[model samples]
Target: MFKKPLHTLKTSAPLRSSDRRKLKQRVIDAFTLDPELGDALVPEGILTIKFNTHLDEPGVAYLSPEASADPLWFSLGKGSEELIPSVYTLWKRPDLLPFLSTPPAVIPILVGGADLMIPGVVHHPSDLKEGQLVAVCQYTHRSKNGATLSVPLAVGRMAVAGDRIQDGEKGKAVFVLHVWKDFLWDMGGKPQDMPEQRPLAALVDQPESEAAEGDEEIPVDKLTITAQPAYTPAEISTLLQASLLQALSTKIPASAFPLSASVFYETYILLFRPAFPHSVLPPGAGTENSSDIGPGNPQNITIKSSAHKSLTAFLKAMDKAGLLTSKTAPKQNELLVTAVVDERHPSVAAHRGFVTLGEVEARAAKKAVNEEKKREKEEEGGRRVEVRELCKASGRTIGWVEGVGGSPKTLYEPTELRTLLNAYITDKGLVNPREQAYVNVGLDPLLLGAVVTPPKKGVPQKEVEFMKRDEVMKGLLDGMQAWYEVRVGGREVVLKKGALKPIRVEVKMRQGRKACTLVSGFEAFGEGVVDAEEMSEELRKICAGATSVSPRVGGPTGTVEVLVQGKQAKVVVDYLTEKRGVPKKWVEVVDLVGGKK
Candidate 1:
């Protein structure tokens, strides 16, 4: 079964150019429909085709399933997408509408840029080829608040795609697809599926209205031809010079300008000029040896020589030129030599580098003398230690001690008592030096017992002196007792008594019962016992002092030891005056001094 090759339907001559132009305009109009799409078309601008289905598959058939369609791919102009939206809108025109709905699934041929292939086309238009440069109109996609639209921009091209489709009329409609050669392989569709076609130079070339004067409209060959704007030679030269200056300025100094072989030669030529000859002798001077004058006003000169010969030549030249000058030069008889001394040598201490023997001997002698003095000081210190020990043992101050034969332990050992005494003396300044010495010698004054005299044997035990009532009264009268009285009038009174009656007194001596009680009575008008006995001794003494004394007695209550007319008498009375309790008064009987009553 021989199958006929598929062929593209050709459009009639009247429809070829006009229908193609309408389709191109429709593509450009698609961009203006959306601003975001328009912005996308601007930078590195691109012609994008978002197919309803995967581009690898055949396009949808408009009327019959037998029809075939495929993918196409191309580029918009470089950095331009303006032509796409306008051209895409033209695809809906009456003349081009048939192609869109054709049974063969009319694949749109976007003149500016495209991304799909049309079936049944072999070669592109005769005026276009691959790698031929072209301009493009591209639509960009944009989204705002959920709505998406397209906008168009213009761009230039680097290469072209090779694919075509007929316009189904007389003259075959040519499809020009622009592309970047660098991106040809990854156009997202296979070459077989999305057949690409190069754009015609005539289509992208300057418009007829912009054609230069006297320029003829000539048909171009299938080989790609590009016409670029002519560049000004003067502007190019200026740019080149600026580039060279920038490069050189970065490397060379201003002082290195006007570089040329002639300038190099001329600079060296000045060095050899007789007017400025190069010489070791300074500017105003002639030959170095021409100094016919003496050691005054020396000419300036700079000599160049190798390291090994520089010094030697300098001295030789100075001599030959008669320029040797010095305030005091060395005499021929003087000898010069280098010498080194070792610091570890014994003699080295006396002489640093160079010195006279006299100086060396003097220093050595001085050192020896210092050593002897040091030894003497050490011996003296040893002797002083022995003397100090002797002082300690002998209990003497340092000055009192003599000699050096004493135990060293004795120097620090102090008698226990003496150590305590000394510590006390130091802390409290010696109150009594004699007492301090006594304490140091192990004796305390307060600890000594008092001396006693023994009593004579055979003597009757001496009677204990008892205080009689009279004697107690006499003592009270002598102001030895304290007596106070509370009178009936509420006034307090005090008195001294010369005598008091004795009373029976009992003092309990038992543990927890140490108290004294007395019972006594006093006669009043020879009747009942006077209440005076019941009163305290203090009140009795006060009353007795104020009352007249009458010698009245009563039995048992009154008993007296009396001396009448110098004779001793004992009188007993039924009534008596008695005293009890603590004695609050004293009585005194002083010898009469020439009084007779």
Candidate 2:
């Protein structure tokens, strides 16, 4: 079983031109023998870089293609100057396959991020020493011939010498850095399954023919020196029984009553002929001249007529043995199966039980639940909770109110209300075509009186155009009643916002024990024609401190806020309203200059 990764990741500053050059140089030096691998992994079009401090040495991830949000290469430093590929990178790039090798049974455990056990390793060169980069592969057998060994499951790692692995040590043989389907693989979005493994030396030398050259035709004589004995009747029977059970579990559903044996055999059972060819295949199965049947289609490997006759006979035999109930045709070409083979059937009782459709479904369901639980635990540290808050203007629909810093769910600050109003206007298409900056109240009467105050005694206009955007936003918020959203576990209740405090500027302690001021309601100020970067820079200079902008997960783009250094809440609010032209009504000083709001 796999355990959740303990390390957390945060977005780091984008690499400058100078830093990119330095990173490329380091990669080139580390992979001196394989220059193309170094280039493909850390391409020039990288978008972002993230740092992981959890490992023995710090890890750096390089994302590329300028548009992709996920990293293509995750590199870990063995010491100061040398670097090795992480397991994640190896899964995607098979060109590095010459480095490491392992056996088949160790693949699942490696995908779960477990260390490679010494006992499971089949082969590695004696020249392979500790601290070298390597690739791990499963000793897979050819699909058509089990005697010929092939390497299909490829992973990457730091190397440990063969002598050390043979020391009978109980610890890990290879320290697994990453794996397929782990948290890092799923970081930006759903990752595709790792590519099928290819020959190690060929992939390293010829990149273009890797896919076409995956399977090599090896003669059976080369696979074994001694002649093999023919399978006995009992062995053939066991193989057929296992194949029958597998086909039943995968193709038949519990609710599919009175199934047709002819359709089942044609679709499901025939597909297994390649796996159990010697036991399940009908006599002279592939001897037919099926070339005239169709174009671009290979000859039928299993003769349909013979397979149908044999399948009907097999079903009837099972029915007589009381494994299932079946109705057979006179020509033995079809059968109607009624019920599944009961688990308590005497014939299969010794082999645990007959596998019914219900049992197969239960096992599938259990697997889904375990995967969901694992994903939830991986995201446990950062939870996105939405609160139901009534829009002061349109109380008919509940608006989503999200948590900021540490605050109770009540009342919408003027800035937060502004974001909601803009969203409503966009959603309703209420903007006048003639005047893009003005709202067209004719689309919805509620948006007129509720969203903005009625025209004043001397005013003649009735829409958003007459007033500034801030004035219209303020008027709408003042006209509506406040509401509160209370949440407990999975249940949420909404009530009127009575005597609830508004939003404010709060200072929080971040990494390195630095005090940073968090301004929550500035979301609306960054929208439309507003310049977020210019505003952030101004705040930094005004407060004489460093500043950064971080978007709240699952929150609107309008809610992306700024973080300023030290205790500058009071100063920030004054600057926002007076210097930046934000209205004072939209700015609230709910918290003290140096404390929590």
RMSD of each: 61.1, 23.0
Model 2, span 320-437: residue lDDT tens: 6666677755685567877666444444444422333223323333443454445444533222222344434334122222211212334565567667667877787767777677
Off by over 4 Å in 2: 1-38, 47-50, 54-57, 77-82, 86-88, 98-174, 186-237, 242-322, 326-337, 340-597
- Relative to the true structure, how large is the alpha-carbon lDDT of every model? 0.24, 0.49
How well does candidate 2 match the true structure in TM-score terms? 0.36
Best by TM-score: 2
Per-residue lDDT for 103-151 in model 1, tens only? 1111222311332222222223334344443323221111111111111
TM-score of each: 0.13, 0.36
> Using alpha carbons, what is the TM-score of model 1?
0.13
lDDT of 2 at 326: 77
Query: How much is 18 displaced in model 1, in angstroms?
Result: 20
Worst 10 residues of 1 by lDDT: 294-303
Name the runs in model 1 displaced over 4 angstroms: 1-239, 252-597
